[model samples]
Target: MENCELLEKCVFFNDKMGNMPSTASVIKMRYCREDSSGCARYLVCKALGRENVPADLFPNQEDRARQLIASAR
Candidate 1:
């Protein structure tokens, strides 16, 4: 599949994970490239808008993402 449209702009990858390239690479492959719809950041961005997506949110934190989405509605 194509990479996430947010790949270049994602704060998690561009800033938060910049110190850990190897780990970031693996995560990017899984969530950003393979399946962006499953990414927590992507979910929040879709549900609440990019401005509401926390900078600290991680791709694996789907539960938290869901909570944020729910709270918004």
Candidate 2:
């Protein structure tokens, strides 16, 4: 599947699990930040780009910040 589609699926999975739909949380839970730079919004945006998804789906700083906070919990 395309990256955006994959991302959407990943988020859906997170939602289903009652977890926050943020990459950082998933990364921390599954892969931890030490192994990587953690899950950054830019990476998600890039993945969306790879899937030809609209950038507007995830505006930018605002969305990222919101996701980050949600994931921090």
Candidate 3:
């Protein structure tokens, strides 16, 4: 899959698991972008995919990602 797709999937999985890594965590890991968009999530997901993490392992990843993004105040 493309990097963007992988990142999205990773964010979905992570958020679903209730372990949403903070923006600081992402920044410390150098995954966050200056752009205030979903780009950070995408980057993190792509990184996870590079490590061979399977998105299918989390059945509700997409839904969870959507919910997390929506619920973010």
Q: Please name the candidate that would achieve the greatest TM-score relative to the true structure.
A: 1
Total backbone collisions for each predicted model? 0, 0, 2
- State the displacement of the C-alpha of residue 4, model 1, in Å, after optimal TM-score superposition: 0.5
Question: In the order shown, what is each candidate's alpha-carbon RMSD?
Answer: 1.0, 13.9, 13.6
| TM-scores, all models, native as reference | 0.91, 0.19, 0.23
Top lDDT hit: 1
lDDT by residue for model 3 (1-73), tens = 1233343435443454345557435542332223323443443244443444334333223455445445542
Candidate 3's TM-score: 0.23
Spell out the clash pairs found in candidate 3.
Answer: 7-45, 7-46
lDDT of 2 at 39: 33
TM-score of predicted structure 1: 0.91
Return the clash pairs for model 1, or none: none
Kindly list the per-residue Cα lDDT of model 1 for residues 3-39, writing each as its tens digit. 8998899888777777788998899889988999989
Candidate 2 yields a Cα-based lDDT of 0.38
Q: Which ranges in model 1 have alpha carbons more than 4 Å from their true place?
A: none
Give the Å error, residue 45, model 3: 7.1
